[model samples]
Structure formats: C-alpha cells, structure tokens
Target: MTDPNKSLWTATARPAESDETSHETLHGTHRTDVVIIGAGFTGLTAALKLAEGGAKAIVLDSVEPGFGASGRNGGQVIPGLKYDPDQVDQMFGEASTDFIGRAADTVFELIDKYRIDCSPVRQGWIQPTIKQAHLPTLKRRLLQWQNRGCNAEWLDADRMQKLTGSPCFVGGWIDYRAGSLHPLNFVQGLARAATDAGVTISSQSEATSLQRNGDNWIVKTAAGAEIIASQAVIATNGYSGSLLPKLRATIVPANSFQIASEPLSESQLNEILPTRAVVSDTRRLANYFRISPDNRLMLGGRGTFSEPASLKDYGKMMADRRMLFPQFPDLKVDYAWSGRIAMNREHLPHIHQPMPGLTMALGFNGRGVAMGCSIGGAIGEHLLDSRVRLPLPFSEMKPLPLHAWHPFYATLAIWYYRLRDQLEN
Candidate 1:
C-alpha cells in the first residue's frame, strides 16, 4: 500500500539550498496595494509580478507554499488550453487566438527568467493515440495547432516507438514547446522569487471572509488577522472554499491521483522513455507518465470523483499502470497522493471580476500548471493596469445551475467516461 500522506515529488524533490523568504505568520491588521489569497503557483506568480512592478503585494495561504495542486500536479508544462486550437478559435473567435497562443509560451519564459531549479527538461511532450479510433482526433488536434502557427510535429508509429521506447502507442504528435518539470520545486522557486521581490507571503493564514470597506477590500483570516487592500485576487483554484460562496459554486473540484514507483535500474530506464519526455495517452480518462530526474516512474490519471480515504484504495490505478507498461509489470509503487482539479463545464479557464476590486482566475481544468503560471502574470498585469488586455476574456461569474448537485453529476460523468473508455478499447 502506498502512503497517502507523502507524494513522490515531496519525498524525492531536492530541498531548497537556501530559502530567503521569511515564513512569517499573519498577525494584526495590514494594508497592501494588492492582497492575493492562496500561495499556489497562480498566487505566487501574481505576487512576484506585482512586486517586480513596484506593488506592495501580500499573499496569504492556509498552508505552506506549494501545498496544493501547484505542487501536486504531473508537472507537464503543456502549452495551450484543454480545448484544441480550432475549438478555441471557434468558441472565442479568431481574434482571441493570438493572445491564447502567446499565453502558452509565457510559462517557459517565466521558468527561464527566474532560473527555477525544478529539473525542467525541454525535450517536449507527446499525446499518443492509444487506439486507431483516436487517430482522427489526434490529426485534427495537430492541424488545429499548426493552423495557429505552433511548431508541432506528427509522429508515426516508428517515431513514437523510437521516442517512447514502447509499442503501446500507434501514433502521436510532439509539441516541442511543451516540457516537464518538478512541480513542487517550481512552485517553491516562484515563492522564493516572489519574496525576493518584496512580496509578503503569510503561510497558515486562511482567509475566512471577504468584505468591502469603502474603497478597499477587507480580507479576514481565521486567526483574526485582517488585510485591507485596494485590490484583491482570489487565486485559490481547486481548494477554494466558502470564503467566497458564489465563486465556490462556479466550478467543481475533481480529484486526480498519482503514483510513483521506486527508482528503476539503468537498464529498465533505457527501455522506457529513454529520451525522458512526458507522455500522455489519448483517452477520455487519460493516463500521463514520465521518468523523474532520479529515475522513478511517475504515473498519474483521473481517479474517483470523490477523494479516497487511503492510497490502498487505488488498486485500479496500479492495475492500469501495470497494463500500460507490461515491461515493468513488477513495478512497486512507493508513493501515492491525490489533489483536487478545478473543472468547468466548458473545460477552459475562467477569468472574471465577479465584483469591483475582486478578480479571480480558476477552472484551468487539468492544465493549471502552465496555464496557472501564465494567467498569474496576466492577473498581475491586470491588477497593476486595468486597461491591459487579458489573454482570456473576463466574464461575470456564472454559477453552475443546481451547483449543489455537482457531486452527483460528477460521479455519473466519471462512470460514463470509464465505461466509454472500456468500450472504445
């Protein structure tokens, strides 16, 4: 049985040699130019940008930095949204495509500019077609990105086998612009950068209530501390709570579980993903995997709609992993953990200002690692200068109808998808 408390990333990630930021707790009343709630990638990235631009930003989180999805994701720096390029163009129109395209590239630029030591590999990411039926969709996705001037390449079975060192994939496409990294370390690097730039990060400071006071917004913490700011950002993506009841109702938080095996032998590594690129299969309930810098095989997939009580409950995932890579059928999983993913009905991120002085960016679906980081900068720019245009259109918060029944709906959807995936296979 895997340990549910410890994730493979947390267990194996290199500790920061030196942390320049002070782990101060929030106390008393404080005032800042901008107050960001949540210390994940989005909040930290926004705080870093705002601080760099000479804004006094204060970031508050209920737990330590990178304690959420920011640190607990697959770490695939995949460029683009959950939607295909053509779908985005069709949904939001052609005029929005350029901004969306540029937004995807900003994630890599941020990592480079900050010199984040997250074991990032720019080898690229592969979305392989697991079945012949998936080939058309893969081709359409490739053409959509190519139409948007993206440097993507289609890979035949031979090329896929050469790169992945596996014959499971029939065909695939490689996005050179996409890559992978140690997600936790990357978020920690962002925290360091944000603090170095003079952004105040208060850990263990949960914002309980938000109220408007004249021209300013007052955020009250559970410990009775308060932050009064001219502008505020609700950057809490999946773990968003009742702090903003309306905002919480706008999206559903689905759980994604991941498992990692003990370090593989050099020979074992050579026979699987020798090029060390991130690979994800084309399935409704897809599976993604890559080799860690230390040679551990990290695998992730959509788990139960509800959170599991223990890592031992993920037998299905373990079986799935073994089936996918029969070459390592005896792989023993050392760590298992799960995190919530904020999903919207549209499967795209939602950027909105539900009220004056309050801006929110959430519902990245499962693409929050790159999209969250990029959108953070956009949030910083937007907060700094309202006139600045955003990559995603700002729309009013549209609460999902019958939001209370989301859990029921989520369970039904998961079952439907799982059944469909089985039927297709």
Candidate 2:
C-alpha cells in the first residue's frame, strides 16, 4: 500500500536534525516525571512546555514526528472552534470564547519563539461563502469576532474576488489572526525544540498498555520497553487505538484528502490567491485551499470512509478543484495524500483525566494545527500546577453510542452532506 503519510509537506519539508535524533525504537526501562504517547503537535507541545517548566518528559510515538495528521493536515492555522463565539460561550461559558479567540496566536508565537523555519505566512485566512444563504452566518461570525477585538473583516463579492481570484464566492470574511505554514516542518521544529529543551523522544515505540504502578504510571511499549512516570498523557488524536478502547471509541476517525498542483508561474499565481491568504469555503464538507511556500496550489476536503490505495481515488477532489478554478483546467497534479481527523459528536475538543496522573486530549475536529497546540500548552500548564485552569472543561469519557458502527454511519452522513452541498451550489 502506498503510504499516505508522504504528503506534500513531507516531500518538500527540509530535513531536521531533531527528527534524526528522536527517531529510535524504545527498549529497556526508562523513567520520567511525565510520559507522553503520540508525538504529534499536542504531545510535542506538551513535552516542550513540561521540559521548559523543569519537568522531565519522555515522548513515545508509533511513528516519527508529523507521521500523523499534524504533518499531513491542510496547514491552515485556523483559530477558534467549529462553533461561533456566542455558541462557545453558551456551551462552555465566557472564558472558553476568550481562549479560543486567541488559539491561532499559539501557532505563530511558537514559531517565533522557537525560530522554527516552517515557511510561516501570516497574511490571514478567508472563509468564503459557498452559497448565498451562508452570507448572514458569515456576517454574524465576522461581527462576533470583531466584538471580541479580533482582526476580522467582511469581504463583499468584489473584494473576495480581488483577494481569492475566485468569482464563484459571493461574499465572505477574513480573520487576520489565522495563517498558514509548512505543517510537517512546524511539527518537526516542535520536536527539535522539545529535544533541545531536555525532553527525550522515541519514535516507533507504540505504547501497548498503561497501568498504575505504585505512585507512578507504567507504560509498556510494543518493543517490550517500559516507562514509569508520575504522570502520563495520551496524545494520539485520529490515530488513537486500543491502548484505551474507550478513548478510541470516543471519536470517529474521518479521513481527509488533499492534492497539490505543480508550482504555478507568476501569472498563474497572481490569478489565484495573490495575497497568499489561505481559504476554506462555508460548506458542510468544507474545502480548504492555499498556495504553498513553493507556489503550488493545494486543495483538500473530506475523503472516503475507507483508506485510499492510490492517487486514482482522488478523482472527485480533482474534479472539485477544476470546478472551483476552471481557469486552471489543465493544472498538473504533483502530489496527493490523506490522513485521519478525529471528529467528536460535540465538534469540540475533549479533555479527560479518566484517572489521576493521566491526561487524554483529542478530537480537534479538523482544527488541530491551532487548537491542538493551545490545548496541549494548557494541559502542560495544568500538569505543572494543578490550580491552572484548562481552556475546555474536563469531561467524562463518554464513548459515542454505537461507536462500533461509525463507518456505516459516517458513509451515510458524507453522502447526505455531499448531496446537500450540491443542492446549495
């Protein structure tokens, strides 16, 4: 099977010494103040924060850094959750709204602080209106962020065309705080930063079992390695598995697919996203697109329930690209890949400490780049000092009802959403 993890980011990202240093199979016994499983953005961020706070942290991952969605995502650092500010306030009180409003800042701040050379671009993010009826919702969303002192702006059809070079979009809004970067490089940078800060990271060391041992938690890895720590964190997001059956069942792993065009000429790039702002449409199954640092046009959206074996499976998404940008009807596809995103029933990130000294955070619902980092930092702070409050409230581990049949349910939901999106078009 073709490895879908080899996305555009991996193909183009510069090699990092940290990745080389951290890529090793775990063996023998190890000890730390905190042990973290899954070295994606959340785990690495938490590890870096913990190490900076003078705590010993050991990070273990089934694969190398950015091997999962953290490296394979759309790279759009979108702020906030799927819900609007008011909806968030209603659901989780006023503090969460404030926290979410500044989520994307975490990404940029980390990039700046660590000097991670990930092709950071902070122009902004555009949420283009796919249907006329979505305009009101877009306007309301813009106003809510504006009221919260966000750098939000309303874009009429003319202005939208000027910014995005796509005439199909009627209107939209741009959040200046949101941005894009080389996601894989960013995650690798995080790994390097963590390692530099005295954290130990091991790759290809899948935690098989976790147990309470005396005053510490013992984590057994696939390679027969053991790690004993005062605290443990399960940072596996969409790639979560049977290490904790209930935790894995709490989310539906939805595959997201993407394709990148060959690097465009200056003229071609000018006719597309000239300002370099990343864009995602206001559709049920939203489509995200951006111009990469190399000037390749990239577009991504929901993929099939089953894993794709080859590039031919991306036919529909390629068609979507042509439909949205008919001017580039003959654009050559240079790269294609897919990765899973954890979708929660509530569409909000869940923080659970099912037991003392163990923390589990997952289900970013396609906003892992920004929100994941925010949540990870918060968890790190909480671990350092128990009185620290998390952005999201800790909830009981409630597995979705009929979780085993999620594939069947997800297929139906995708079909319904596709039909509705077509109707809207």
Please state the error at residue 397 of candidate 1 in Å.
1.5
Count of backbone clashes, every candidate in sequence: 0, 0
lDDT of 1 by residue, 165-191 (tens): 677889989887788889998888899
Error of 2 at 82 (Å): 0.8
Would you give me the overall lDDT of model 2? 0.91
Candidate 2 global TM-score: 0.97
lDDT of 2 by residue, 372-404 (tens): 999998899999999999998899999998999
Best by lDDT: 2
